[model samples]
Target: MSGTSVLALRLAGPLQSWGASSRFTRRTTESAPTKSGVIGLLAAAAGIERGDDARLAPLAALRFGVRIDQPGTRIRDFHTAHHAVTGASMPLSERFYLADAVFLAAVEGDHTLLTGLRDALRAPVYAPYLGRRSCPPAGRVDLGLHEGARLHDVLQSMPWQASAWYRRGNRSPQALTVLREAGPGESVQTADVQRDQPVSFNAAHRRHALRTVVTLPVIPGLAAAGGSRDMHDPYAALDAFDAVEALEDERP
Candidate 1:
């Protein structure tokens, strides 16, 4: 492990919430995973605590990207609770999540550092969650480690990680969208600016800066093929996904 490497992740789960702008009573989620959120996840896997910014800096500097393999439905919920100290009812919170979504995430950086991070994920000190604590990963996050690889190459060339149910009705790579960090000297006019770059993860003063992102197609081995994707309800495949899971569980 001497040079650059990319660590890919499979981020499919029953629910996910990547909130960039969270308020006191209303928490909203971004459509895809955020850099800050994903970095925080890696830090947790590496056993870095919330207040340890010194250990968090290297993970934060890694380039990040995510492919929307399955852009799940946005659903909302109302949360009500009581304050333990005061025994008073807390204000109602309106929370949002992406249900039945599957994402492919990747981070690129020093090979030696990435290797240790991957090993830590295999046996994490603190469990990883989607953007919120209530949402957990449906399965293992590790995809594989690609040495001497770059983020763009790994994200685009990897096979579509969408669920089998999603593949039945949709083109895997053809219908997918990749949201990635801008390349060197990429025009700011072409990329969308979002406030997700993590500066610190200390609970007392969590901070994030802005980063530019560009959207592209997930056409890897296939030649440029032009066609329209069939529009279907994001929640339409719930039953099928459940059925598939049952079959998997029943297998020896």
Candidate 2:
């Protein structure tokens, strides 16, 4: 048996509050940590604790992807606290309200960990959400596992729709245009012009990077090609990959 790798994703909506900062008179909002937070969620699914961060930190080697579906609107909350005049227990004050927000996240990890993590999502013992208690997941987890003769092969052929805002220059070259100008496996360095300079977007770059991730071929058992995986240790059993295959195979 060999180990597998898969992409684990979750889409959340409604209202959320990360509660990154809070004070007696003022408060603030913080977006969720797409990388660390998803890892922590996986740790929780694996029954890992805060103290286990070091032990499980190695798992970070796996690639992570997050898609903020709604990017929910931000809102402000208000609150107040009180103290007893007699030096006794202080009475609670009135509750305040804030605006609603939502976020979506996707994480890629080892197949074994991912498989168990996916099962945990079905009936997770803990509450796995985007950011706040009020904001809940909009739908089921969106999990995907590259399928082909090999992981690298699948990644090389993965589909990625180009952005519509792209424009080619007369004398300069762009990353996406380079992808179109040159054949596959080509690289380019765009010139730093004033107005015709190339543009980079995190969203598009994330998608592009994700498509190239399969190039790394994290799935175990597959023979390492072009230094994609560890040549010496490529026969380990991958739970996440196996689970993804099983799940996809069963899907219509």
Candidate 3:
């Protein structure tokens, strides 16, 4: 590894769409965030224009991985548009999205580069989105930056970041599924391939190359972080209700 730092991001939203490939009028989303999508987010935060391939090269070189804290359900919708000048009806399009999903995205690279990215994320030159412009992050994307840390290690050490309600329903100790770029010297048949490795973000000549990805089940002890605190019981807060009785009596 050439770099020794990692940047962590908490990517959660009511609706997110990460499409590695878009076919004509049909756009489908992946179950988790893709490397190219996250790189696009960082590039936008740094104010790098879509056509600036030189600046994006270093960002694309960073190792990318994501922990699926919560794999929200997939939903679809259809959309149609009309030509602005001609006022002619356009073909209908189908789009898919993930609802109520939460993810922990991590990238490891040079310390200086990662630190700059962390700052840009805090106050981005351009607004950041989950995967598309329509799917803005529910909250801040910067969880923190880890100096002298590796990509998978930082991702594995984070606490469960799922929403309160979602964790309550699934109280069991769960093993989070992690998808990360494979390390050097892995067998070709063992690693999966994705064409999301960005070659250029230019809308006119957008291109991607294949990448080897390895799936690992990490964070098996999620129950420690998903204990009773996140569990939902109808009367779980009744003890505190007694102290608020005076305020309740004054309600108009």
TM-score of structure candidate 1: 0.85
Give the TM-scores of the predictions, in the order they appear. 0.85, 0.44, 0.86
Q: Local distance difference test, per candidate?
A: 0.84, 0.38, 0.85
Ranking by lDDT: 3, 1, 2
Each model's total of backbone clashes: 0, 14, 0
User: Which 10-residue window in model 3 sums to the lowest lDDT?
Assistant: 223-232
**lDDT by residue (tens digit), candidate 1, 1-252:** 499999998886789999997889999999999999888888888889888888988998898999887799999999999999999999999999999888889999999999998999899988899998899887778888999998989888877776656666775455568899976665656778899999998878888898888887766534321112222335558877999999999999
Alpha-carbon RMSD of each model: 6.9, 17.6, 4.6
Write out the backbone clash pairs for model 3.
none
Evaluate model 3: give its TM-score: 0.86
lDDT of 2 by residue, 161-204 (tens): 11111111111111111111111364535421111011221223
Error of 1 at 24 (Å): 1.2
